[model samples]
Every structure is written in C-alpha cells, then in structure tokens.
Target: MPEFNEKAMHQFNQGLIKEFRENGGKAVSGPFVNAPLLLLTTTGAKSGKPFTTPLVYTKDGDRIVIIASKGGFPTNPAWFHNLKAHPTTTIELGKEKFQAKATITKDPERQRLFDAQAKVMPTFNDYQKATTRQIPVIVLERI
Candidate 1:
C-alpha cells in the first residue's frame, strides 16, 4: 500500500469539486464516475470560511449519509471537523441543492448505516480495518 499524501488528496478533491459543480453535480470522469456523489459545503472549523467537498453518499430515508473514512487515513477528514463546528450546511445532489444539518450517528445505528453503504461500496469495510479509530457515519438531515 502507498502512503497517504494530504496535499495530493486536497488537489484531487479540488479537481473533483470543480468538476462536480461545473457539470451539475455530476462527475464526468475519474474514480467517482457513475457513483452516487454529493457536494457538501460546510463552514471551516477555525477559518469560518466555506469549504466544499465532493463525497460519495448513500440515502437513508430522506437523509443523506456520508462516511468520515478519509480513504482509511488515521484521522477523520477535515470536512468532518467542519461539520462538527458548524452543523448547518448545504448539500448538492446532482442538480438539486438543499440545506441540511449534520449529525454523527451513534453505536449500532452507525454500524448499520456503515454496513448499508459498504454493501454499495465494499471499500468502506476495508477503510474501517485500515484505521484504528472508528470512522463516523454522519447523517445530513434536510432542513
């Protein structure tokens, strides 16, 4: 396995975010092609600036679910911290955009949602094993 490069990952994320926004939230090519993805805009934890991240998501009965897997990195993704500092955020799924509140799922519910998403993208299971810290499963409830 290769070492995780935060700088490279940030650049890649920026490219995907630009593509997703330009193409009406659809990624024309790249790893997320044909995958269910969303653009989450959250306030920076410390900077108070808006930061948008393109993430794979799974729908859960009127809510959007995302994982803080960070590609199995030891630390949770920055967006997760941003959401923690500012729970109210925005999400764009395809051409639809909506306001949402982020909440971290707990316990068995987290595991259940994680499993549901893992079924769709099995790499999530691998992500959990790659890191010791429990990855958070966050629900974006439409506001």
Candidate 2:
C-alpha cells in the first residue's frame, strides 16, 4: 500500500471525484474501475459547508451502505462525522442522483454488513485488521 498521507489522499480523492462526475459516475480508469462507487455529499459538521466524498458502496434492499474505515486510520473520516451531524444528504450513483438520510448501523447488523462488503472487496478485511478502532458502517436510506 502507498504511504498514508492526508494531503496526498485528499488530492487523489479530488481527482477521482472529478473523474466520477465527468464520466457519469463511472471511473474511467484507476483502481476504481469495475468497482462500486458513489458521490456522497454531506454538510460539514463544523464548517457548515457542503462537502462531497467519493465512496465505494453496497446496496441492501433500498439502502446504500458505506464504511467509515478511512483506510483503517485511527480516526473516522470527516465525511462520517459530517453525515452524523446532518443525516440528510445527497448521493450520486451512476447517472442517478437522489437525497438520502444517513444512519450509523448498530452491532450485529454492522458486522454482518461489513463481512458482506469484505467478501466483495477483500481489501476491506485488511483495512479492518490495520487499525485498533472498530470502523463504523453507515447506511443511507433514500428519502
């Protein structure tokens, strides 16, 4: 894995976000190709400004699930906190965009969903083992 630097990751994510938007939510190249991804726009907790994050997601019935793994960093991602403060947000999946409400999943269900996602993207398992803190799993229910 590459070195984990916040600044570098931010720049990289900016590039991915741009590509995702320009390509109708599809990542034309890079590791994200053939991978499930969505643009989640949230209200910043402190800044109160709108922030958008590119995330890999899985669908469960009518809900979309995202993990706050932060690539197994010690702390949760800012987007996670943002959504916690303002549960209502917007999600862009493929060519479709819609509003949704975010909720943190509880235990049992959280673990189950995490395992299901790990099965699809094995790197998630490695991410879990990389950090001491238990990553959070968030569900986005369309409004």
lDDT of each: 0.93, 0.92
State each candidate's clash count: 0, 0
Candidate 2 lDDT by residue in tens digits, 3-110: 569888889889999999899999989999989999999999999999888999988888899999999878899999999899999999998999999999999999
Q: lDDT for model 2, on a 0 to 1 scale? A: 0.92
Give the per-residue lDDT of model 1 (tens digit) for 1-143: 47889799889999998899899888999999999999999999999999988899998998889999998888899999999999999898989999999999998999999999999999999999999999999999999
Candidate 2 backbone clash number: 0
Q: What is the TM-score of each candidate against the true structure?
A: 0.96, 0.95
Name the 10 consecutive residues with the lowest summed lDDT in model 1.
Answer: 1-10
Question: lDDT at 106 for candidate 2?
Answer: 91
